[model samples]
Target: MSPSFRPRAPRPGPVKTQEELDEMVRRMKGEQKAPDNYRERSLKLHGWICAKCGREFDLANLHLLTVHHKDGNHNYNPPDGSNWENLCVYCHDDEHSRSILADYLRGDNRKK
Candidate 1:
């Protein structure tokens, strides 16, 4: 197949009815439950420091730091934080930008 001519496979998920889709949107917008406090726990487990740039954060500036999933799966939080890293906002943005650039270079435009 040509580079841009890959065949489209059927998406892998149960088909939802219209009402179910609407309800899901509503829940996501307003009534979604908390996502298991992984961020808070990861922050505590790894200290409020940027693993990328080694920047430190205190309570006053801690909001500038964010927990990043090393493997890019938010739902895969392990108690030991083996796949987590604390990165400052700038570093996190840079990391994502680099990933995007790499994907573009490799012609990987499809959503993962």
Candidate 2:
């Protein structure tokens, strides 16, 4: 049999101590940037109301409220809140469904 056909044993790597592993994890976490709080900023700027259905939201039911990007680009958030719209869960679903249907009708097979 050729050398290429021979099975090779796995190479052993240096095992890390618990303290070393913990330190590595801590350094990784520290190096990571905090997630953007655009949702909170959008809620503050556009009030707690759905732009499409005009449904209002309060602290108790604020979970149903979501921030939507007007231009369909999630990364195109502006500080002035021009591209963001506060939408209720139902309206948000409907808005996405309409866009999907429109795209289907137009034969847009490209994934968004």
3-68 per-residue lDDT for model 2 (tens digits): 686688878999889999999999999999988788999999999999999999889999999998
TM-score of each: 0.67, 0.68
- Model 2: how far residue 72 lies from native, Å: 1.8
Compared with the true structure, all predictions reach lDDT values of: 0.91, 0.92
User: In model 1, what is the error at residue 73, expressed in angstroms?
Assistant: 0.6
Judging by TM-score against the true structure, name the best candidate. Answer: 2
Tens digit of per-residue lDDT, candidate 1, span 1-112: 5578779998999999999999999888887665688889889899989998999999999999998999999989999999899999999999999999999999997897
Identify the runs in model 2 with alpha carbons over 4 angstroms from their true place: 1-32
TM-score of structure candidate 1: 0.67
For candidate 1, which ten residues in a row score worst on lDDT?
Answer: 29-38
User: What is the Å distance of residue 18 in model 2 from its true position?
Assistant: 14
Residue 103 alpha-carbon offset, candidate 2, angstroms? 1.2
